[model samples]
Target: MAKDFAAMEDSNRSSNPSIHDVSDPARRTVLRGGLGLAVTGLLAPLGAGTLAGCATAGGTAPPLLGFKGVPVSTADAVTVPEGYVTQVIAAWGEPVGVAGAMPAFRFDAGNTAAEQALQLGMHHDGLHYYPLDGSRRGLLVMNHEYTDDGLLHPDGMKTWGAEKVRKAQAAHGVSVIEIEWKDGRWQQVRPSRHARRITAATPCAFSGPAAGHALLRTAADPAGRIVLGTLNNCASGKTPWGTYLTCEENFAFYFKGPERPDAHQRRWGLRPGDPVGYRWHEFDERFDASKHPNEPNRFGWVVEIDPLDPTMTPVKRTALGRAAHEGATVATTKDGRAVVYMGEDARFEYIYKFVTRDRIRPGGFAANHELLDHGTLYVARFDADGSGRWLPLVHGQGPLTAAAGFADQGEVLVKTRQASDLLGATKMDRPEWIDVDRDGWVYCTLTNNSSRGGAGQPAVDAANPRANNTMGHIIRWKEDGDFDGTTFRWNHFVLAGDPANDRADAKGNVNGDAFACPDGLWVDARGVLWIQTDMSTSAMGKGDLARLGNNQMLAADPKSGEVRRFLVGPVGCEITGATATPDGRTMFINIQHPGETPSERSDPDQPRRISNWPDFRADGRPRSATVVIRKADGGVIGT
Candidate 1:
């Protein structure tokens, strides 16, 4: 659903019918047995019953819910296993905070910027459930990836006024809602003190070596340490210290107006005009690069928020090295040091890891508040032989010196892509999300690369072999020893596509559970990997891609290389953001931007409405919401 430079460039070129073409031999070799064997070997150490609550009454773990996977569905409802039930917990415009008189979501009317800020933000993406006392009551922290202005405002973005723009800004950050499981259902706790919303207008602080860098200074905040808010929060993770790590993604589109173009703006894809059509410059001068050039630099970093303490301001952890960060998953070494794996979600972007200089302090949030502030950031370089190395971005480490335009570590992190270029890191296909298994294997989702094998694009390599990769794949690797090590072995777990389509990954899609564009990913408590799809809007329900049906979630057994479709989302939506209870009984997933079907004509008077999911009314507008799923027999999910 998120488009970048590749999408814009492809749209401008002459329509090439061969863009999605896949050679038969290439498709057959996409998911080689060697790759699957490598992944299976790495995951084999995770014996059965490793996942909590997975064992049956006889003390043997049941075979994963291979319950004849759900069929491809085009219906306007969430389709899960035969016994599972789904209910909408919270939706957009539902009041969250302690504000008086909580209002019900209105389909026809629009909420004010202040009201929207107090409600659940739009387009819920990556989410995690933190149990306050190891039970049902906990905080649900999630990211509002982006906004759909057409549905947010009464007249749409075409006639957006300052108020509409402000409301849009108020809907783009993160939401922390208090939820509880009661009477066999999960529901939101309205007006709970823990229920708070952090919008783009909220104040945030910078931490780490790059905190006070000159590149981050802005007219509004000359100190360079204080930023107004976070933007484009896509995928997220929870830390060992109990804080939430929300990643900023696709933030370049929010800024415009640099009188003269520079390397920083060009590298980040910021152009002269509004590319994705959010003309924030029209309302705030800070959005104009010419007026506040350094403002954009403050974003694109991993933001840390302490959800337990609502009064505490979020921190932009600059030590993580900034980019279009899709998400950052944290793992700890035996020595208790924090190791975070992050992916830059853009075509030809590189994956990165950050290892803390000090081990995490035992005393919880207050004692380990600044653990992330001191970490060595490293970019990954994959080799053709299935081995890889981590290249540190420290200034003067190798070619990163004054001659290379990096004076200090702060500068290297501020321009992380340039540093990675100097280090010759492998350019990957839109790396979206990363999750670590109980066996310490790291998995990353490469969400397709349409530009591969094109005239001017990067040639296919062993890691990314497909020419025009319409269907995405997942790449996994193991650290040399543990999470803190540098080198590792890697392989592709699955190359996703339509099973009936001969051009797709036939071997991987043998069971007819064809899926494309793997995006949001999570490794649950039991070591089962859950993958969510984000098929392009233009490809969904059409041609070869249509056979896969709507975007869906799948459960995969890493050790056995067995994948089964778990749930199919409603029409015109991407199924993403998954988390489960500690006992692994109930699972929560976010269905983002449902019913987002685009119109073929440019008729403003008669806008096309494809679906109204969750609240299926012919006249109702579709709103993104969190879906809570549970088994009818109260058994562990996926088993």
Candidate 2:
């Protein structure tokens, strides 16, 4: 079904796994009044006669309306742009019985210590395709987020143990599969009633602006409004009405804290590497976060999900605060409200945006599910000449209320980076993903930082215009053109690595060659620019040329800023979390983890699998699938 690629078959190769199902809906309307048009991206990088003058004079090219170039080869499967074909769809414990049975992952039973509403949930990251109202069949809201315990548990998880750690915390959260594409392949529709799985015992609800506050009150919710679980979830963003959201990256590894210090560890901010419970807390001493410091404040923020009502409860919004969150994008604000945009992924941490105060009335999904719930979060400060400013953490701004030391707005939102480093913001290089193109720009991704001191410790600004950024960059902004305007204008368009590790200039690769920690991001709707990498530069044998190569996926050319590479995965993988299939010829990437294989390290039957790979269904157990790239005439891919 991937046909417009021009050529490259045997079902166009494949690889992509980690993101699960929904099985039958095809209602795609996006053509009505052209739905406002939007999504243009165009920028720099073109040559080779400008992609051979768009192709023809025997070079052939003219397929847009869908599918373009960026094939990226490696085998194991999924590599379109020649007439796509990747359909292995759903994975991760193929069962949805409601409380158990995904049991074959074996990462040493460390499912974050279980109770995750019935297990089979581990590492699936950001996904959303909902649809349903007109039928064409849909629903694929995934984001399992963590858990590897060695593989799921057979020789791993037992920091002390408890029912193998409550089936590894019920398997780590979120999953609503019910997909479809009929005979052209793409299955997984078994358990019905929308097939739920919300986890940590699902029952969420906490509107915004940090709900109840008091560091979020513990002993499990205590009036902070029912907060039991929603750890990690990672990279997600959907609401324009359909509802999906999901954010909470790395939730500081479920917390463990016990370096000894009580009075609830001096009232909350407990550090000592932050553990207060780690052994799954013997299965439920509230998971023991040092007798539960509000259970890590109920995990970073941004939840949302309602994929056609999987019993609808998942709603952690909290006016969007809580750090290490990695994703959230939304968009609106011209006057219609509903903003969103976020990042806070650590390193220097910051970059946010909320707005909301309820405005969006586009109608549907119960009015964007109460339009996100009271907003205006701001934070971001940049400048050295590129200009930037979102500021306004509210509560009379300057020093965030409660007399300055921030004892309000939930400690100015759990120390939202010490109130954006005292509202000065700007300290990036690990921002991680935020995407938003169709021309409102807003990209984000900074992903790299060797502790920056070879020169540049917060030096050379202008929205982080590289100074010690070894292999990482992709900033962008616009706002006034809308997209929730908050005073914008920024740059640093594409500076990845390995064009021979850079130094070439005029921009053509050089500084450490090409590819390093760019980290999960996406923009495709024809603006191109994919990126994706993470493992502190891939981390395999640690040679660090972004982890010895093959953790790729780059595109660029947003109208000629031509960056290439397209695909390379396999061997201790990392090229993760991507989304497409509104007819971008189906691309759903997410290879993830893959590490620890040197002949499987001390051998357990040659499991050294750095990637026996998707090798695209020819039989080679390296499976981790989610591929479907098309173009032989269907158009609109990398065009």
Candidate 3:
């Protein structure tokens, strides 16, 4: 999730042992050995073959990276290697091409709420491309993390009304668009039947153990079986049975509560005033916690959508144990059971994993409807000696009994953070996104936690060894046996910062390129680990972070620990979400919140002061869009 809307409060008040507090902290400082195998012969890479329904293929030791690394860039444009080209396919406010109403994006920001519904939502984040005709045509499903009202209306927040609130709400959710390769470039198919927008008002079903719990029940949804919409959708994942996993992060920021919230609300970061000043509660009663107390509980779960089937209602899989989920990455066990690894994007949080009780059947998505529901969710605890344990969050187990505030499985899953707190899960430095490599190793991005080692905050630990960690690092772990195993060994992949910095804490151990705040992550064919960074908008091109330039994407060799800059985004934007064709020739990535000012919002009268990307029209407001990249010589990307 972007820091602009993240929950600012440190809610975990637990005394669970930090990795440094465990035995032998000094021995745990060094990263573990190189990821075992060479990247060349890995069986199933993350993109194309693993995602686009194509037969997985590999060579007998192909080079991990073949392109020349681009230098650090501060320019207000997309920068790629010399042999590659990029095109803007989908952007915020553009028509999603739904039938009967395809509203074009208004450069002056005069689009109404009704028109915004028919168009693409704002701030494209995590996305996946599902092939329809062998990558030539596919459904590009992406998440719209949040909306910037300053750019949504012509006059911005100068005036407030219900209609303006509705427009802002309309711009928060997910977009599924049909895209195809035409005339050597990717394009959105107009009036596409597959085009659909799931917004904050869209109806969604709740499934899994915590579905109908009293905490999730509200006046509008008394049965607790339905939720109005899924907002704050950040990073994403795809299921083995062909479904999209859109995660809800920073949902706590939307609600406006009383002067004093209850324990449950406080635990979830709900406070007295509107910390984010979203002001949605003034227009929509549902956003008022004083009115609809349980409405906030309805969100913060991973939603499963079948992008290929628009008729199907998206389901909020409750069994995944919610906690401001950054994203869910799925891997299968030796016997076909699904193992899901998720990260909660907040300070002092814990990593979670879910293992289904039943094996995935022969049939497609329908046959696995209940697979995610009947799983055992576990939180990770990284020990000082490089070992870790997955503590099960089951009712009546360990400290999660009736005496500890959990009465049943539903309560255990609903209060997941409290449950993990009682089980002594290791406190981490803002776990963001989790992905599994072909070698069965799980990697997660720990975006910097400025509060670490500060006064009245958790001190620097072995797993998170920096005080006021400005530049973040990546943590990787390999399970003892399969993805569903109860134990694993973990280590840091790289500490991200400039090696020449005067401050020792800010100088990272990066091998090739110096980058900060690693966020989005993916492993492509030939086992190249792609990393995307999201430096805070206020800090980019300033202070020690200035030398790093704008937010960029880099390719890393897992075997040799070499990182190379692949692409640098426009000013004030985040380079996130990566996908590629089945042939590995074409690739897709999202540029989010371009022209974002230091305040994280643009001034309506002077919006173009920061950036004017993709379409630099005089009246244009910076728009978040998806960029398509392919090699000029018609060869595999990065090769």
Candidate 4:
């Protein structure tokens, strides 16, 4: 479930499913029944005072640095507009999981759950910062989607050895860290109640319609009473009532299923499709597609966790349905309903939104927890003319008719792919991240998919128009009347890649496009779209166009369609996991797998420093840390 952009573009595996990768089981474009998410993979200070109204004349505001939409020079470090500084917060191996400080990290030594519990997990992805009661301190919850087998074990991990495999398992899961700003530097509060880790060994429960469905039943969970753990957590969100929502991505590879059952050979579920990729079955019998046809049903759903209270077991809210759930971003509706926008993350998959029934009572814990349980889940059906509609997935609703084979709510959730198919939701080119700006516009990143369905593959439509979409794009739309409704207006904002490349502007979408593999996404307080890239070509050391080498984080002025690359990661790295302080004076961005390449990567202190990052840190370890960017005056960021 974990791979860099190179695997996304080059490897046939569905890790990222560039265009053609979707149609086959081995490929990512297809959804893994119950597996985990293909855990996925940025910075910059924003400028001055709520520069009320549009960007001042020169893309800059009075008394503040004008944006000018000018591109930053390609350098080997982080960049900020002006008067801003960034600091590293944590790295992959720094202590956190245990009761006290972590021992010197041994890439080769054996670390048990107790030892690993104190250290940070691998491939840090989406995160949440929960302000603590009466204190400037907050809880930082992060997802360690998967492990870097080579980096975790002394010798590369061999699946055959339970000891090595356990270490690898110990590395997979979530890490909750306690962080507070002291003397202006964010430091960990060692021995704090807020710091903790949740791994594959952690027990979790399933909720919603499919909680006890037949597909989820396993030998370990004969009655489907429990799910052992949550794997490959990618993008995530925070509940209005203060819980954290972490998603499971690329979950299929974890299980070693048997052969493809007769049903699979006929036609795969909901995935637009995949033709080739990893033969995970070769590794373990659990991966056998035939024996556990229903195994995949257990995963690929949005999970909810309460970080403040670490012991408050996490849950998979299947009410949101399952697919390659990129992540869910929750917002309130005009009527006070909690609306969560989610992306399926597979080419041809659908974009969905779940509007809760109970109104979020703002700071109302009891109300918010119940808000997600009951909601109307809708899929997007966009038209070529830019107008769109939401197709309902309610049991027995418009498209959830008996003819579709989804006669009950559980079926709708377990077979979300089929439910969406019946609704005819607009097919996309690998939609990955979804966010809602304060302005109410919904933005999504359709990460690159080299295969445009093909002769039989879905063609480029208005919503997704590009045959071989090597240069991915970000698209946005406003709900009808600028409200989150059933219908909306849409437009392609930016096409990605080298500005000089002719194909970059294939559909006039490249106006502000300067990077590829637009994966992780978020909207700042200023309405500026923050985009981070996952470039496989760069990770592989191939040609520059595909291998820009340095994946960057860009800020886009949506109204003007202007964009800029404000930060670039180290060698062999992809920028990801970004969040801004409420004050906007400081912003936190994650640098994951700095040097993780398709062939190999370097260790923490030795050979092939695959990536030399978080360089600005006072400590020279160059670990993957959360970089906090702040303006000197502590003024609002990105005016």
Best by lDDT: 3
Go through the candidates in order and give each one's C-alpha lDDT.
0.79, 0.56, 0.84, 0.64
Candidate 1, superposed: residue stretches over 4 Å from native: 4-6, 9-48, 99-101, 504-512, 599-608
Clashing pairs in 3: none
Higher-scoring candidate on TM-score, 3 or 4:
3
* TM-scores, one per candidate: 0.93, 0.33, 0.95, 0.83
Question: Worst lDDT window (10 residues) for model 3?
Answer: 34-43
Candidate 3 overall Cα lDDT vs. reference? Answer: 0.84
Model 4 lDDT per residue over 1-639, tens place: 135322232212222222222222221121121111111110112233333543556665443323423243334466555566677777777777445566655543455645665688777888767777323577788887666555565444333355555555567678888888899788877877777788766788888777788777887688775787777788888777888888887775555444343332222331222212322344433445455566667778888888877667888888888877777888877776788999877656778888786677866454466567787788887665456788888888786867867768888887776667656677777788888766666788888766664644565555665677766777777787524588876665566656555553332334443567788898876666788887662333554354354677877665455666677766566678878666555677887776665554443223234445655332233345577777677666654
- Report the number of clashing residue pairs per model: 1, 115, 0, 60
Model 2 TM-score, 2 decimals: 0.33
Count of backbone collisions within predicted model 4:
60
Candidate 2 vs 3: which has more TM-score? 3
The TM-score of candidate 3 is: 0.95
